[model samples]
Target: MTEIRFLHIADLHLDSPFKGISSIPQSKWKEIRESTFHAFTNIIEYAVENKPDFVLIVGDIYDGENRSLRAQALFQKGMEALQAKGIPVFICYGNHDHLSGKWVRFLLPDNVQVFGEKVETKTLNIKGEKVHISGFSYKERHVLEGMHSHYPVANGQHIHIGMLHGSVEGNMEHDVYAPFRKNDLIAKGYNYWALGHIHKRQTLHNDPPIVYPGNTQSRHRNEQGLKGFYDVTLTENNATLQFVPSSAFIYDEVEVSCEGIVHANELINLMEQSLNSYREANGNAIVELTLTDISEETSELIQASSKEEWLSLIQESLEMDHTFIIVKELHVNLPNMERKESNMLLEMMEEWETAEWKHVLKDLYRHPKGSRYLPAIDEQFMDETMQEAKEILSKVVTRGE
Candidate 1:
């Protein structure tokens, strides 16, 4: 058996205009805007230095189907940089960057290869050993079909790998892209399965190693923590995986205790300490601080002002050096959300059943150009989002303290 080493990254989502950050000043835009590119660049630098056998970018490279020219150019530049180092790159399109939409295509380095809409296998001979990688890209925005069955079973001769940008059947957090089961991939008898779409990295199987490297960068608070890629070494019998942190700016959601604080100045001091400590441990971070068990006076003062105003005050008070800690949002003594809804929330949900999705998305479907590529609304996706919508709305309507 031949040993193979490669870097696996997914959901680069380059050129993502991070939402919920409009309040940030124009000067801060440079870091927030360039973070995605910076994240990917770090990964490329690693591949160049380490000299992996190849690189695997599973899917959803671009944020959307209509990718920006800058994003395309930057991506090609990274690919070319790898080509210079004699490294190869493999790519597939996820639902977010499906092939259906019209966009400008750049001339990529010959070392870069992209999987087509049909399920196909590409073989590589490294160190006189055969390596086969099987995958497919999304032609349409929604791929409800289970393409896993189309994947060729491993021949058991050398090394076989699978790349899929999809969610598991029961995963309701992210959109259902190319859906599959854990058992389905195991049945393929591949040495490794490189997955994408879900922003949080996970290990589905241990032995042969089925994994999701998560997104290289984060675009929202929901995709929190240290984001990065995976450096994998595979053999016929087993695979070893190493996670490499690559996010230039990490999305860190911190809940700080306001146990003994009375004055607003005290709160600021505590937050400053916390931020500095976090920055020391991790690199630069975009933090959303949640204050708990605050004094009555502080609560009144917090209630008097909006979160935005509080956040602005917090931002202005901080004096951070190069290892910066940006307070993106502030919340005051909010109760923890419960999975089981209260009577009042359950009553409100009764009316939601009568709601129609067609009425909600009528305008988008009616558009002359949009209707061309738009498929029917995914029912599973709708049901999932509905639950999230209920949860989000419940927090507002049922909140007391």
Candidate 2:
């Protein structure tokens, strides 16, 4: 019953441009740009302190196809730290950081084991217990075939781990690269499956623990909440996993209800209080403020000719803690006035929900070039889109009347 511990991290996305946060001052911009490196350093420091048997980075060490020299240098530095500690690091290059003939490669530490562009297996012996790690790196931008089928079955004598960097079957958010099914992975009889390429953390299956550690740092609002790695401990009979937060900054959305706020001062006060709540929380976070259930006066302030003036006022009065709750953008959703069933806007939404709407868009869907970019106009999305359109229409109709 030998126990082995390892850190599982994926989608480091080192040297990301931080395009969304580019509007900040140069001083702040420099900090944000280096945030990814800071996070990777944290992972290394954590490994140094914990002395894990190995560190597993599933993929996408660099953000783009043409790897940046700085990113490679920073990654080598982390590997050097682990190498000094006599710990091993394993990596499988993902879609974004896939191998290319044109890449100017840098030498990694001796202790680092990077899977090649073909499916391969590496064995490790820790404390007299044998462990088998199997995976491959992407040779090109997209490895669409099911690579899981090529994975070797786990020999019962050793703990087996599978490292894969691709989308699970049917996940449309990401391109289908190295696509695999949960059942296929389970059938491989591996003790654990380490997954990557998806930025949102998820555990597809728990029996043998198919885990996606997500990305080390989130660059966009779509990627919200805590971003970090997983500390995994495996024994002959049991496996345990604990999440470790490594991100220096986070992106979050905070919604403030303007239901009762009468004066602008009162609204500002409520927003300030909300911002204050993030002060003692984990790390620095940029928040997108969304004001819902807003009163008619606030609606006018947001939509009238004085809209820019009101926005400037809100931004100016926003008392940031300088450490937390840094305001980024504001979205105002005006309260819907009580309307009768026969309201024109409501009737319009009902019409949008009808089959006739699909018929109207049929030509657009059939267009050779336009259809590729458009998502299949499914009923659920149609319902949501129509409702959103109705909200905008209601606002305009109310104002016009």
- Estimate the TM-score of every prediction: 0.81, 0.81
Question: After aligning candidate 1 to the native by TM-score, how far in Å is the CA of 205 from where it should be?
Answer: 1.2
What lDDT score goes with residue 181 in model 2?
A: 89
Clashing residue pairs in candidate 2 (N, C-alpha, C atoms within 3 angstroms) = 143-178
Name the candidate that leads on TM-score: 2
Q: Scored by CA lDDT, what does every candidate get?
A: 0.84, 0.82
Report lDDT (Cα) of residue 269, candidate 2.
Answer: 80
Candidate 1 shows a clash count of: 0
Model 1 lDDT tens row, 1-401 = 88889999999999998988876655677888999999989998899899999999998899999989999999999999999999988999999899997899788889989999999999999999988999999998899988898999987887888999888987878888778999999999988999988999899889778899889887888888889999998876668899999998888888888787777778778888888888888888888888887666666656677778878877876634444578887767644323233545555544454245666678888998879897666666566766787777677646734
What TM-score does model 1 achieve against the real structure?
Answer: 0.81
